[model samples]
Target: MRLPGLILIVLATLVPVIWFAPLAGERDAVALFSQYLGASALILMGINQFLATRVAGIETIFGSLDRIYILHKWLGVVALVAMGLHDIIDAEMNGLRGGPLSGIAEDIGEVSLYGLLILILASVITFIPYHLWKWSHRLIGVFFLMGAFHYFFIEKPFSNFEPLGLYISAFCILGIVSYVWMSLLRPMTPRGHVYEVDLVRRVGGLTELVLLPKGRGMKHKPGQFAFLSINDGALGEEHPFTLSGAPAQDRSLRFSIKDLGDYTKRLHKTVEPGMEALVCGPYGHFSMPKGRDPQIWIGAGVGITPFLAFAESLRTADAGPVKLYYCVREQDDVPYAVELENIAEAVPNLELVIVNSAEGIRLTADRIAGDLDGDLSTAHVFFCGPVAMRKALKTDLVLKGMRASRFHFEEFEMRTGIGLRVLAAWLWDRGVYELEKRNSALRQPAE
Candidate 1:
């Protein structure tokens, strides 16, 4: 099942408490509702902590690590909103005398809420340095600990032994355990395999690192990604990058990284051969499908990394009738273009099309269908590009008779900002377009 279904199931499990929990006479409806929201926020915060653990096999349940991270983001957002509302709504109940520790608990709760707000703000502001943002993010668990303490000591209508109380307490335990495991215990344990970098090549904005395992290497399929952490102090943080080469027997790995961020820019300049590295995955579900259906692969800019793995895999594997479109600004911007052309020449079932957008050769749905002789109805479309391009192409392809289910792409952003300004501008543009359309229709003669 998808993440939304799982989230619904979680909320559904809590809904019964509203009816089953014993109440003290007739309470203020708004106050009681706010209390429930507070409870939900705490429960969701617990699940949010669990999701951050990155435990083995958990990605399978959410389809991919990308989706898991997306769910993690949304859960935090909802929990934050609920918590804010609970705080603003004033959930104090009459005749419910405070617990012995209620004063201390209330103070802790206030601190946690404010601390969480500041940390979350740091996370949402994309301009911050990655290391600083990460450090702030780690401190969030401390606030969660404070929140749990507040929940434990705060006075409420239900007794500690009551059903609702017990259920929430179980979640508190889950959150605490998850936090300990992720932030403390997990780091102490060895993870992934150690590899020594054999070569480092820089071309334009791209940096390619070739690594040979010092011990047993990770087993991975084509088009999967891994978390890479170099032992150097400057590059110690683990960052996810796609495996740009096909899996080999000697357990070697290759990563094609673009200098897009602060850490990557530092890596491009500082990383050298013989550096110790840790590789901790083979995650993601963006692999070649098993069926023999015709395929259309679209890659733009550095998004072309995965398709490199896919193309290399075709040497021994039989994937029938694949059309690969490599989109870049110009010929100079295209990485591994000659290699792809050579592969296409050697493999009869594969065809390579280079679309240079700078020269006005955009990869549109019409262009795709025209090249395929309007046989796109049966072709499965795989895309990796800017989010706007993906949305536009997907909409156009579906309108041109391609199945919506056949379109596949990963959510590429590892960290996303709220982009409120962009959203507001888009909404204003949409409103103006609607108004124009209405005016045009009204001016036309009756049919």
Candidate 2:
């Protein structure tokens, strides 16, 4: 998804090897292979650190933090694979048969490898508890530090490939420094614009947080999201949420958080007025497109939050024709239906479609096309809902003639807590539960 950033990382990892290939000097086969392995691991580690930084430019390229994290997780896995291969290759060749002092350096590398392998696996495999995963994930830089120490003191390659060694050393240092700043320094640092809770409203399974900027408020686009930490982690940890309302003249912001987990479920009662919150973002790229193409929005459950902001901003607008499909399990589950209906009625070219599955009304590509003035290919489609809903609908639309490039969606969940169970459940919901039921209905002989 983030091809440009991925390409840059690849170039950064390989360009050094290409530049220094000539000067690497003649060596035995085992020694050369060992050097290659070490260099690859070092370069990947550097790239891993760079991605972990979560800088604005990377987010811009990746389109959202969710995509950035996907890249980050995959990069870690790739780096781990490279490092594992290097370990295996070197162990088989017995290249580092150094005695005494050099053996200590080799041992350091070995220990670092095992430690990193454990930590990275723990971070990835969702079975582990969230707190444990977070702590172990932070410990990765420590192992990387050890690996750097080993790289400096190791017996091979450094004799002739001193420049390459120094380059890796710089990366290791920078990686560790970046990790420290991101995990430690930034969290501890205070913000210039602190917000106080102005109101807390509970609507169905969602809690709406209204914040009043005390000093310098964040200016953001309608569909952008922000990282909110209430009472400095009193109601659990900091989390990202999409702004539900348009930027107000008073600099007050609104966020709708659904009860997805234990921490979020207690938010309505735990949060009170006058409570101070640290709002860290205004991030994400889920917004209206540049052109005036007709927009087909598919919002499910609380995924309607961004669309709410979009509708609020349409008060005095001249955009293209718009059709919104708001899907919910039941009519009672619909949030902001009244507000959205009012906006749709007032807006000249906007049309609203409410699909309640409980009433036997479902959303499908054929249904959307039937309701539209023209073919589905003529409009741009935006979606924000359960991952399963997005995947199924997107696939169906694309199969029915919509261009893949015309579909867009953003993930609100950061995925720190995602594990095999979560993924399996998601797959089951989108796959068997939805598909099998439809298939069974279609297979009836006469109905």
Candidate 3:
């Protein structure tokens, strides 16, 4: 069975035994069910804590692990809900609950409140966007630990019959506690500006920002990306951008952006020299690591940005025997064309193949595969381009026997104004939403 299917099956089997414990005809039997519920809580909490802490450390490591983290959270919610029934049923079956169940209300309320807090905290941290939720999220780790203590400690005697129950509770507490320590105690450079723009220019609809770092700056492997947030918020709303500038002296950073989105369009119009831009970065697994075989870089249009950086970085050390196959629909679409030529001219190790689609130089991975004499065995291919082009290249490269692990590609950012267009249209359909929010001057508090 699939991982999710297995998880659902395990939860399905465990929930019912806990729910109907009070109907089992024996007081001790119900306590046994409560102990099982406690064990589930511990297991769920431990997994969440362990993954959350690991996610805090690095970028791509956790990016790839996000699916597991999501599953762990869903499991946590299920466990929380199931355990509530276990606790309530156990209390009533033992008659420790008072007068016509009037006393049981307070106990259930206390237990449910703890369970509800866990649900709320987990749901919020998982569902809300980072900008709106991160500040309040740090305490969730504490909440999980505190909730565990409230549970196991209240039913302390369960640990005597179910020794394993105590162990699981301890694991959950430690896991979340460990997450808090890793997230807060790590000596990472606190969220701050990575570079300041020295120049912002518009070439047609594209924007080029010449950046200078305010600090020692970032040292990243080739084929990686940084998240750029141009706001004054501590942790700004950012998008991943491949570093176009070589990491050398002067700390000069270069970024080429298309005027396609609300953010990028505003950047073209408003970005100024000396403006602060927070860059939390160097994320992605696309870097051509050492020991990589004869590789080819397949670039399409503006996706050639990282190849530009890689070329310069490699040129400084006369890096490799790799070829860069770049494709652009028009001659003018080649970003930093002059720099590309300079790098090629200076490095004998580098081969720059500019396929100008304007001249009907229809290039593809299949052609490259055939031309290379079906010897893609030692070649690692990196591509960043239009969806159609990347898809074709991947299909052809794999067909030619290139190893799957050797191919890496990045998707381009969607147009910025598209999101705003959707938002505006949605609000326009609702008079109250528009009048209370964007109908500025007319926007006011509603009764």
Candidate 4:
């Protein structure tokens, strides 16, 4: 977890306690604690919305969107737990309540809780299609608004909780503001660079798109990704993809997208040369450092895209010994395999280790540990692959005395839109990834 995000979560959890501790002695103990729980959850949720904003400062502090998403996920779980505790503890208070407004408030709170649960669950389960999941995510703002209504109108032990009520109200307002900006305003804003589709190739089961900027191109480092939205019949939905090649003077960009879902499946057929697209950002920090020790690069299937960029960046440099472990089910499944081989042959310090699971070759941590000729402690390991692979390798390597900080990976699996459809697609892809990994593992050569 990023230090700033961790700090924010700690403060958000503790500040509410600090604010309400003085009033604890004046009110019923259980009632005051429940109110405090609810208040802290709301504050955390507001901070959650803020962190989701792709602000430069937050991204820098959080290190990358990958870490940001992790913090975002944990905060959501904490908020939900807090809200659940609040509901249970406050359930008996309704029997002693005396007004119509209080009953209405209780009803609103109940509804918000249920709605939030559904939305968060949809987000957690990636099997939900992206289109439906996208909509489900947006409904959170509606639930938050209702929660704010409940907070303001409800009968409370600390009804006169001074500016605390006002503070929560501000959070509610900001939550709505962030929802509007992300779902509406951000998409409407023109991209930093507009590109014409120079070429679209269907290779294996993936679509390779080549983009040529129409005006001044956005400068980006290798291994970073960009969001692309085609103006053709493809709904103009922006999708993040890693740059598959080094920075060039022509400012041409290439994205190798695997046909995992509906959007990508139709990409080759729907997108054509001369088509225009809005390109925003070269986001992410999945790159190697210049002064670091030998690098261990791992890429599985389409995850090889970033490694291609990294290899391109290292072509002219005399970096220390680097080994790339490229994994795929078959020779044909490896994207950019030929180009990668050519680059590896040209760079003396770079070595390519191709692992074809079809032939019972597996790229496990123990296998890598055995293959390395030098001390593993001084090597920086970078991975871009399925979440399961990353987790397994990271765990196994860490247990073998490798520092966790020496391992890094990028997570492109994100809740992009505020809809259930998007969620479903993400979930569906995640399920497929896990299944593929399992099938591949079953084919591995036994030790």
Candidate 5:
């Protein structure tokens, strides 16, 4: 979402190559390139560790925590690939002799590479439970430490005091510090505002938590989310949930959590009134748009949580003429449906539309266009839903004269796969499409 952060990552990866090139002397070209890949891998892995810390204000550089995590996931994959290449390409420098500990360091490097591969695979595989995956992910820091040890002790072309060596050494220190802070120090320290559970209401698979501030509560806007961690033993892990109510003077926060994962299911069953919890945010930029321009808000299933906060905030805030679409598979599955309807009634500029797919009703782009007086070019559409639904709707709406820039949604999947199958299928489809287009053009006769 932001350019500078990504630009910095690219610069970090390439600058070392330039710095090391002048000192290459008569080294083997392929072997030296392999060494550069190793340096790039270590640098990228260091950045990954820093991102994992979730430092405050870092999200501003990357847009949101969701996007930050996406970058984090891909960077790890790329780093692993780079490491694999470095290993396979044979980086033994000519006339470079090992020090006393070089043999042990090289062995550690091999172990780190294989350990990282297994851990990263565990992360990519979706069948593993979240807690187990998280634990395995934490083990990455161990391998990183091992790799850093190898970098320090293994015989290389440059001395530790050289520019190239110093640059990489800095990242090694950064990686180690980040890992320690995140895995060791940060957890020992108390973070975020403490709150007591004011209410726990369950409706079907949805669990609503209203948290009352124990001391100073977090300040947040509508459509923001917080990481909530209940103090109960099994439920102590922090999980992100969108705030489902408008910010009030009481400083109470509301979270509408769907029982989608193990942690959430446990929270639904075990959480109760008066339970102590920690709330570590008010994160995200999924707020309502300003100005009097026409706006369309679409929320599918539990994706409606943020829109609930937006709707509640509309009671006082001055804004646009808005059409809110609440899409659900069944009528009974809609959380806060009545509340949303009431808000729509109270807010003169707001309108509510319910699309129940189970009753053979669909929220199609043509239907939306028709409702907006057969023109979609002037309207801004905000959506929160499943990935397939978002992709399809965005494609259709853009084709129906809506500007691509006006279609907005948070790309907020916490655990996404490496997408090997998706990429292969997309490439295959594109090739077939191109071939068909070429054949059609050839048969068109002097077009």
Candidate 6:
């Protein structure tokens, strides 16, 4: 089965356990429950990683999939909160605070502390835009391992009755073990392409890099991304980066990055050729053609990276005709400027329009339509950029009466579980409100 399908299934099966946890017991039950929540969240993260590598052309949502991305991230947040509550109650209930250094309570307390630390680290790292936070964020994988250990040995929630309790507990622990083993220890090279940094250069205000695989072709479709890591750093953390080059006919891959944070800043001053990098992925659904008709690509700033890959692929007859209306703050902000035009020249169907806003050039979808000659409604718009710009474009598309199936975007959400739960809860609340409104209207005397 595809990784996305498998991951979603695992998560869906586990969701019921957490949902029913409150009914199993009292306050301690809630605390006990939190550990499982964390376990589930970590597992989902692993699932997402697996999906990125194993699934092809699979998206989290059918329409503009930002909703799924948000859900995944928020679910991680919920898991964090649950772990916090788990620690507090477990500490107080077991008198763990008073235990000796080597006692069970101390170990549990230490584990809880570590879990909290992981949450803090992941949350903090996510705040930085793209490449800066990208590399270091891979450390969360280590924390996920720590959390799994904490889940099983921390509280020993097996102290319950009936078959389902122990059965589910064992299932959860097994899942955690499998996820951790696959994530940190296992390597995905498999006799094909292993990643290596080709060149790291200073372009405009950013440090951009070119990546190529070692000994094998780094095969991927256009509009996909790969995770990156520098092996030589004090903190060898991996981050996801969108492919910025045309899809390789020979399996070579390329990436462009900017120094948006501490990780990239170091890359600017330090990263070099011949050094190895851990690259995992080619994930995301920001692609142009995906069982759809003509596509429209919307971009801003470095978000244009993936679209450049799409356009490049179109240039080489890699896929199909894809029209691009890329937005940038200034003419200079567009990466691979000459290459983008060169490809457009080679492929007549691939139209590239640059809105130079540095001196105040304004643009919208209406302006974008002038560049292409086709049924605009048939085009599925793909976007990757700052959150403000992304949201604005989505709103614009909505106002244009574009169908949901005709829009797509990518936001590399850092977390993965709580958002879905919250969205579900919110939806539940709205349903309740509508029912209440109808009830009140029915109660009123008819005029």
lDDT tens string, model 5, 1-447?
A: 579899989999999977778757778878888889999999999999999888888888876787887898889999999999999999997776458999999999999999999998788776688889998999999999999999998988877777888999999889999999999999999689999999999865689999999998999998788899999998999988889899999899999999898898889889999899999987787887778889999999898888998899998988879999999997455678889889998999999999999999999999999999978888999999899999999999999999998998876577888876688789999999999999999899783
* Candidate number that wins on TM-score, 5 or 6: 5
Model 6, 296-397: lDDT tens digits are 776777777787777766644644456666666654445666778888888876777776678687666555555445246666778776666667766776
| Pairs in clash, predicted candidate 5 | none
Q: Is candidate 4 or candidate 6 better by TM-score?
A: 4
Tens-place lDDT digits, model 4, residues 227-327: 78898766387777888878888888988889878777667668889999888787888878877488899999888889888899887765888999988
How much is the lDDT of residue 150 in candidate 3?
52
Candidate 3 lDDT over 204-229, as tens digits, reads 44688777788877666666666687
Q: Write the per-residue lDDT of candidate 1 for residues 236-354, one digit (tens) a residue.
A: 88999989889999989999999988899999989999999999988888888877889999999888889988998988887779999998996464678888999999888889999
Query: Which pairs, if any, clash in model 1?
Result: none
Candidate 3 wrong stretches, greater than 4 Å: 1-189, 192-194, 203-206, 231-235, 258-262, 329-332, 355-363, 385-392, 409-447
Ranking by lDDT: 5, 1, 4, 2, 3, 6
Q: What value does the lDDT take at residue 114 in candidate 3?
A: 76
Segments in model 2 whose C-alpha atoms lie over 4 Å from true places = 23-25, 91-101, 159-161, 331-333, 416-447
TM-score of each: 0.91, 0.87, 0.59, 0.86, 0.93, 0.66
Regions of model 4 farther than 4 Å from truth = 91-103, 157-161, 190-192, 331-333, 415-447
lDDT of each: 0.85, 0.77, 0.62, 0.79, 0.89, 0.59
TM-score of 4: 0.86
Query: Compared to the true structure, candidate 1 yields what TM-score?
Result: 0.91
lDDT of 2 by residue, 1-447 (tens): 567777777776776666447644544555466567666777777667767776667676654776777777777778788788778775333343333467688889899999988887787786666656777888888888788777767676444245665677777778878878877886788443589999988877789989999887988888888878887455747667889989888888999999876567657668989898878777787888866778899889888899998888877666788888888886564778898999988888788888889899889888877766447786789999888778988898888878898898987556543366777889988887888889989999984
Q: Mark the 10 consecutive residues where model 5 has the least summed lDDT.
A: 329-338
State, as a TM-score between 0 and 1, how close model 3 is to the true structure: 0.59
Report how far residue 203 has shifted in candidate 4, in Å: 2.7
